[model samples]
Target chain A: MNYSIALKTLVVKEVYRFVRIWPQTLLPPAITTALYFLIFGKLIGGRIGDIHGVTYIDYIVPGVILMSVISHSYSNVVSSFYSTKFQRNIEELLVAPIPNVVILLGYVSGGIIRGLLVGLVVALISLLFTPIVIHNLAITLSVALMTATLFSLAGFINAVLAESFDDISIIPNFVLTPLSYLGGVFYAVDMLPPLWQTISLGNPILYMINAFRFGLTGVTDVDIKLAYLMTGGFIATLTLFSLWLLYKGIGIKN
Target chain B: MKALSIRNLRKTYHNGFEALKGIDLDVEEGDFFALLGPNGAGKSTAIGIISSLVTASSGKVSIFGHDIKADNAKAKSCLGLVPQEVNFNQFETVKGIVYNQAGYYGLPRKLALQRTELCLKQMDLWDKRDTVSRRLSGGMKRRVMIARAMVHAPKLLILDEPTAGVDIEIRRAMWEMMKTVNQQGTTIILTTHYLEEAESLCRNIAIIDQGHIVENTDMASLLARLHIDHFVLDLADPLDSLPVIDGYQLEWVSDKVLNVAVPKEIGLNRLFAQLSARNINVVSLKNKSNRLEQLFLDLIDTKAKGAHA
Candidate 1:
C-alpha cells in the first residue's frame, strides 16, 4: 500500500470539505473568538486589572486560543466522520486497502490542521487587542498540536457511536462546551473557591489550557511538566481507543 | 483462475435473521454472472460479505488468488462494487467523487486524474463533472457511481441493481456501457430485480430462494430447462372453443387467437399437423414471455412449494 498517497487523499478530502463550507466551519470560530476578545479583553479587562502579573487580556489569550483549537478539532472530526457513516460513504474506505492506522492518522491530521489554523486565526485576532508573547515556542506548538489531536480523537469516538445527528450534537453541547467554559478559558482556577478549584483541577481541559497558558504567558497553577505528560497520555489513550473501535467496527461495520 | 470463489458462506445477523445459509459459488474470470433472489433471499447479504461491507458468520471468499482473510488488501484491490443505493458524498462534484475513489484504491494523483476523465467520458458523465451530485437527476447520480467504481478499473465489477428505478433508455445505455467494460476482460457480477436485464446481459445465472441456492447454471442451460414454451398463435378463423391436441395445451385467448403451451420434446410439426386436420389456419405465433423469466418464476415457485411441503 502507498501510505503516503492514501494519507494525502484522505487529508485533502477532509480539508476540502471544511474549506468548501468556509462560512460554516472556518468563519464562525473566528467571529466568535473576536467577540470574546472585544467584550472580555477591551470592555471588561480594564476593570479586572492584571492577572498573574500580566494584563487581563494577555492572560486569557492562551485560553481563548486553546478553546478554538479544541472546538474546531473536535467538531471537524465529529461532523465529518459522523456524516461519512450516516451517508454510508465510509464503505468506500472500508472496502479500500488503506490500513486502519492510516485512516486514523489521516483524519487526526485533518483535525490538527483545522484546529491549529483556527487557533492561529484567534491568536492573530487577539494581537489587535493585546500584545502577545510566547514564553516557549516549542511548548506552544506541541501543546496546540496535542490538544487538537486529543479532541479530534474524541470526536472520532463520538462519531463511531453516533446513530443520528442529534447524537453527534449531544456530546459537544452537554459535555465539551461546559467543560471548556469551566476549564479556565476566561479565569484562573486559583480565583475560585477552594472546592471549586479542586474540581477544576480534575478537569482534563484545565491541564490543556494551563499548559498552553504556560507556553504563552508563562503562568499556570499546575506544574507544566505534568501538563505535557497529560497531553501525551490523552493522545496515546485516544489513539488506542479509536483504533479499537474501528477494528471492532462499532456502529460502523454491519 | 476464478474471478471469485465463495465456500460455505453464511450470515446470521445480530437479530438472528439468517440472510445466507452456507451458500457456495464460483465465477470464472471474464464471465458475466447474475445472482438473482427475492427480497430477503440473501442476494444483498452475499454481495455485502464479498465487498467486506457486512461480516459473514463463516465462509471463505477469495478474489483471483488472494484469500480475503489472509491478504485482505490484495483481495479487495481486485474488486469494485457499485451498491444498490447512492453511497457517494452528495455534496462533492462528480469529478471529485471519481477522483477520490481512484485515490482510495491507491492510484497516484496523475493516474487517478487520467482515469477519472476516462471513466467520466465512458459513463457519459464528463459534461456533469463539475456539478455537485445533489443537483443531478437520479439517473445521472447512478451513472456517477458507476464511473466512480470503474475509476480503478478493478478486475471484477459488482453491480447490485445498477439500473434499478432508471428509465428504460438510460438503462439501455448503461447496459451498453457495461457490455463494453466486460468485453475489456473485466469480470462482471450483477444482482438485480429486473430479470430481463439479467437475461440480456449475463451469461450464467444463480437463483437464491429462502437463503438457499435453488439453481445455478449457465444462462442457456437454465433457459433450456424450460421443456415447455408458451406461444400466442393468431388464427385465420375464430376458434369455437379450446382445441384438443395430444401433447400440447391449448386455450382460446380470443375469437381469433389461441394460446399454446408447446412442449420442447414434441415437435411444432405435430401441433401444426393436428391444427391443419382441424382446418385451423395459423396467422402468426410468438413467445408469450421471456424464456428466462419463465424459468426464474418456475424455479422460485417450486422452491416455495417445496419449503411448504
Candidate 2:
C-alpha cells in the first residue's frame, strides 16, 4: 500500500479543515487561555504566594498548556469526524479499499496537529506573563504528543457514539470541562483535601497535567516517571480500543 | 465473468426497520444495468450493502468472486460508487479530492495525479481542478464526484441517482460520459427515477418495490410484457360519430383525432380498412406510446393495492 502518500494527504486535509476556520478553532482557545492567566494566575496568584518551589504564574503555565492541548485535540477529532458523518462525506472513505487503521491514524494525526499548534500558541501567550522554562524538552514534547493522541482517540469514540450536534457538545461540556478543571489546571492535587486528592488520582487529565508540569519545572506533585507511564498506558489502551471500533465498522457501517 | 453477484441480501436498522429483504441480483461484465424504484424502495439499501457502507443483516455479496465480508479490500478494489449526495471534502480543491481518493486506494502520488488528470479531463472538470469543491456549481460538483469515483478505475461502477438535482444539459453530458465508460468494459449499475434515461441507456433493468425485485429482465422484454401501444389518427373532417375500428380500441380525443391501441400481431392496415369502411376520412396518423411512464405508474399502483389488500 502507498501508505506514505495516504498518510500525507490525510494529514494535510485534516490540518486544513481546522486551519481554514482559524477564528473558530484557534482564536477561542487563545482567548480562553489568556483569561485563565489574567484571572487565575495574576489575580489569584497574589494571595497564594507559592504552591511549589515556583511562583503560581510559572506553575500553572504547564497545566494550562496541557489543558489547551487536550481540549483542542479532543474537540478537533470529534467535530471533524461528526461533520463528515453529518455531510455524508465519510461514505467516500468507507467505500474505499483502504484499511480502517489508516483512516483512524489520518484523523488522529489531524487532531494532534491542532492540539500541538494550539498548545504552542497558549505557551507563547503564557510567556508574556512570565518567562517559561523547559527543564526537559524531550519529556515535555513526548507527553504533549502522546496526551493529544490519547484524547484524539477518545474524541473518535465520542464521535462514533454521537448521533447529532448536541451529542458532540454533551461530552465536552459535561465531562471534559469538569474533568479538566478538577484535574489540577489551577491548583495542585496536594493542595486538595485528602478525599478530593484521592478522587483526583482517578482523573487521567491529572496525570497529564502533572507530568507536563514536571517537564517544565523539574518539580512535580506526583512521581514524574509514574506520570510518563500512565500517559503512555492511556495512549496504548485508547489505541487498541479505537482499532477495535474501526474493525467492527462501528458507526460508519450501521 | 460476473462483475457483481448478490444473494439473499437483507439489512435491518437498529430500530428493527428492515430496509432490504432478500435482494438477489447479478451484473455481467460490460453491461449497463439500471435499477428503477420509487423513493422509499430499498434501492439505496441494496447499494449500501454492495458498497459496504451499510452492514447486512443476512445474505452475501461478492464482487468478481471475492466475498465482501471475507475479502472486502479485494471486493472494494473492483468497485467504484458515486453516491446520491454530493459528499466530499468541500475545503479541498477538485484535484485534491480526486487525488486523495486515489490515495485511499493506496495509489502513489504520481500515479494518482496522472489518473486524476485523466478522469477530470474526461468529465470536463480539468479546468476547475484547482477550485475548491464548495465553490463549484452543483453540476460541476457532481462531475467532481464522478471523477473521484473513477480515480482508481474499478471494473464495476455504481451510480446512485447521479443526476438527481442536475440540469438537463449536464445530465446529458454525464450520461454520455457514463456510456463511454461502460463501453470500455466496465459494468455500470445505475439507480434513477428518470425512466426515460433507463429506457435509452440500460439493456437490463430491475424494478425494485418495497425491498423486493418485482421485475428483472431485459429492457425490451419488460416493455414487451406490458403490451401497451398507441396511435393517433387525424380525421379529414370533424365527425360526430367515431369510426368503429376492428382488432383495436379507439377513443375520440378530439373531433379530428382518434386515439387507438392495437396488438403487435395486428397492423395499421386493419384499422385503416375499418376507418375506410365507415366512411371516416383519415388525413394523418401517428404512434405515440412506446413510453415507460404509464407502465411504471401502473406497476407501482398495483403493488400498493396488493400490499393494502
Q: After superposition, how far is residue A154 of candidate 2 from its true place, in Å?
A: 1.3
Cα lDDT for residue A59, model 1?
85
Write candidate 2's Cα lDDT for A77-196 as tens digits: 999998888888888888987677888899999999999999999998998788988999998998899889999988988897788999999998999989998989888888889999
Cα lDDT tens digits for candidate 2, B1-309: 998899998888899888888989988888899998999799988998899888899999999999998998899999999999889978778998999899888888789899999999999999999998899999998889889999999999999989888999999999999999999988999988888888889999888899888878888887877665787888888989766655788898998888988777887787778778888888987766546766777888888899999
CA lDDT of every candidate: 0.91, 0.88
Please give the TM-score that candidate 2 achieves against the real structure.
0.91
TM-score of chain A of each: 0.98, 0.97
True interface contacts reproduced by each model, as a fraction? 0.74, 0.79
**Prediction 1 global C-alpha lDDT:** 0.91
Question: What DockQ class does candidate 2 belong to?
Answer: medium
Lowest summed lDDT over 10 consecutive residues: which window, candidate 1 chain B?
Answer: B287-296
What are the per-model numbers of colliding residue pairs? 0, 0
Shift of residue A183 alpha carbon in model 2, Å: 1.4
